[model samples]
Target: MTGYDDKPWLAAYPPGRPPHLRRAFSTALDMFDAAVRSAPDAAAIHYFDRSLRWAEVDRAAEAVASLLIARGFAPGDRLALCLQNNPAFVVGLVAAWKAGGTAVSLSPMSTEADLARSFAAFTPSALLVLDDLYVDRIRPILDTGDTGVAVVVTTSGLDGQTEDDPRIFADVDRRRPADTVDLAALVDAHLPGPGVLAALAQRRVGPSDVAVLAATSGTTGPAKGAQLTHANLAFSAQVYLDWSGLAPGEPVLGLAPVFHVTGLVGGVCLAMIAASPLVLTHRFEPAVIAAAAARRRPVFCAAVITAYIALADSPDVDAADLASLRLRYSGGAPIDPDVADRLEERLGGYIHNIYGQTETTSPSHAVPPGTRAPIDPDSGVLSVGVPVFDTVVRVIDDDGADLPVGEIGELVTTGPQVIPGYWHDPVATADAFIGGALRTGDVGFMDADGWFYVVDRKKDQINAAGYKVWPSEVERLLAGHPDVEEAAVIGIPDEYRGETVKAFVVPRPGSTLDVDAVIAYCRANLTAYKYPREVEMVAALPRTATGKVLRRALR
Candidate 1:
């Protein structure tokens, strides 16, 4: 038996924080409906100079739902959303749920090949895509008639923006396909009326029904769609709202890409649960986000650590711009403590770390508000945080047996937030879900206090001279260097050592990095066998749309 079974982390929970949600909405639609009823006139989304109220958002979603239903979109169908962080994305998500269809979150940055892979996996019946995506990706796929798509709704990414930041919308193509249905026209054609709501009620989805097919980052392998039910999404949202102590009408800055699960739940779902205004800057343009934060006074924000670093480095941003952000958080990737500290110093807020995946809907473990996560003594890695509300996290060996506290193994989790399975991939699902617990391929361990530290991905461990070295540990150490802005490590083949450590270093602006000096820095701090033997200087490391490093690309 291990301390995980006793839930030692609860002892470290913030004052008055409950181990479980007292009450949760049955579905994401119920959560959104409650927000509309509680504050119909309150701003739900802020896009540049424009703001959409809760009622307005609901009406728009209802209109879109009506359009979908009219166009033969049926219950249990898949509605793929291929757009960036815009009002249309939110509207499309709610519309899919309202129409009793699962919303498939597709990244706007996805290439044609990437889109094709997802289409084959999910077989989406409909698509609400950005005009640019429609032109480049969807149209080509539609031409081939290989997809199951029947309904196509297109929107310019600039919808709902009264004032566009040139940095974001400059040189943007607002062109729409002449034959495609316009999302805005749909909203205008069907006003806020009881007819649509009445029609939607008959097709209402239950808690267990899949609400979203959140695509995995595909860092380790081919991306699969994680089937997140309405309950999973709603519960995850409640956990975030309660854990962050977000109050009604307090703005939540949208930093994470809404297409990503972290942004979907933390940015969109959390805002609905808290009845808070979700401030959006279209996409993550540092200058635009900084200005919006300054103007909107967003109280909470959760993004990848890189976004924080970008803001800290942005010349357009000042410390006062981010002063109103009290509950700042970073997720999607691990945070280097030095980077977190530097950002906090520049931005005037403590950056809390959150850990989750597409399968978890959003967060399974998050640092409680007002508390700082402790670093692991051995690995020098910052703790991701304690297991979130009602979640069970165990570090297990290959034999499915629990490892003792402080022993590194795969992290497996089970809770309301965990997904039921991967969409349409029974074999993969079976391999991932054992009994009922999700086997997170993350290599990590839980401590005496129940604090969890993720070393690296299990597949990412490097064996140098028969010694194990986690890239994250070495990357963290390299990132601590004053000259290094970012670093990524990989295992490279070496005849003598079997495999040697290689690091790709991104130098800070105006700072020159010496490869030898960088390797020496890691050598001085880390064990000889664990330090990088080869260092490559790069302007930037390849990353996913959600900011997770693409180590495979380096290899």
Candidate 2:
């Protein structure tokens, strides 16, 4: 932020400004430092009805960073952040960077076994956790392990102390005064000693050093941490900031956690770089988030499609304030057009489908309004946008052959935005990177205009009577039905057709749902081979941590 603020990467972004390529000070520490300078007293985070201003967050992060340095913890020490969305999470993130260490994200709700696996793979020097369920689960997991994890801190209950050792510090109220050892004071107290702050000012971390280790959010597999360098996070944050037309100091509604790339980069890190204010929610609640969205009058709100749908249906929805919102972004799962149409009508905002995964650091492509992909309602929903700036997207066959435009194939992506590889998972890493491109298991295609459309997965595609059908196409079609609350599609074996298209529909609380009626609706919208041959109603769809629906769980 100091030496290369004028670089190309930091150039005028948003509304399609060029990328910022800072040779110096691309580290997350400098980004947070700049935020502290730009909006020192503005609210940086608001969660659980508690707020922390930029100045406060900056000092807090600094204090935490200095604490690590004073303890002789040098740069590159991995710190596992296993807490939920809170001011402490941000404090820990910046603190790690300020101390020249990388913050590795751990899912808020990892099982004991999952935590153990992560600890062994990354071998982080410390683990920061919440006390109640999170820390409790992790403590037991470590008790069973032989690895020497040096630091363990709990933010869940920051009481002076009960009985924990090797803690960085206990929690203290940012407004309270006491010898109370909390993270804020920890960083501030350590900032001036041992030339740490001066070294921080110089900014040693950049494109080469790993900035974050984010876990994969794919369903049906063990999560793998993605080693993202400083350049990866910086480039991703810069691209999203530019393409979305978001302005500096814009108000961003934060729901995603630091554990996910989208949540961390777009939700937190982007806000830091732009000095944008944030309205926080510990966990997503449809009505709660909608009420806050209305009151906050945020510039941009990004989350999954379900959250958008819930906001539109919320009784407390203030369509007017939401109307002031510049853009609404959705990721995690493909957007149901019905949801998009409803949001446009209620909030007067474009329904943008941001295509991304944890591996890419967030999103690159977004389908803005006025660009509608062809509505097959049978084949699949077309992704109505081109690749993000400087990013390349391709469709390829199994053998890595380039498929002609408009033909279905595996979606492969390559760019500065793409992740290098999965951390410690050599086999998965090798299989994931095909021909220098990250092989997104997603099955999609590119149109003549170079727009990408996600159909289904190679694993999810259904073949019935030798005809290929995509589940997303049928699910989107049923989403338009009034009685259908939610839908998922899968395939079942059929004696006559070899395979038959099957649909799982979650209906309105009291609405009567019949497979015949739903199939009749798809019949009106889809081709003969694409229509669902069987339909079953369900209560809810299984979802992953990032809120992506798990279609594989279909009955």
> In terms of TM-score, which candidate is strongest?
1
Candidate 1, run of 10 with poorest lDDT: 157-166
lDDT of 1 at 109: 91
Encode model 2's per-residue lDDT on 1-555: one tens digit a residue. 111112222222235344323332366666777888778999887653456799877777677665565555668888788876666788788777777888889887777878788888888876666655443576677667665566665564333222322222234222322212344335435535557568665445767688889878757466788988887777777766777778988888885655788778878888887788777655566555666677676787777776777677777666775665676777777665556677788867777777887787777566643345454443546463556666677778878877776677888887777877887788998988865578888888765555667776678888899998877778777877889888888889999989898888999889987888998898888889889888887788888777777765553
TM-scores of the models, in the order given: 0.97, 0.85
RMSD of each: 1.6, 6.9
Which regions in candidate 2 have their CA more than 4 angstroms from the true location?
Answer: 1-25, 48-50, 70-74, 157-191, 194-203, 368-384, 493-498, 515-534
C-alpha lDDT score of every prediction, in listed order? 0.88, 0.70
Q: Give the TM-score of candidate 2.
A: 0.85
For model 1, the superposed segments whose C-alpha errors exceed 4 Å read: 191-195, 510-512
Tell me, by lDDT, which candidate is best: 1
Please give the lDDT score at residue 280 for candidate 2.
Answer: 66
Model 2: weakest 10-residue lDDT segment is 1-10
Model 1, range 144-258, lDDT digits (tens) per residue? Answer: 8799988898998688875656789897878778868898888888765677668899899999999999889989878898999999988989888889888878999999999
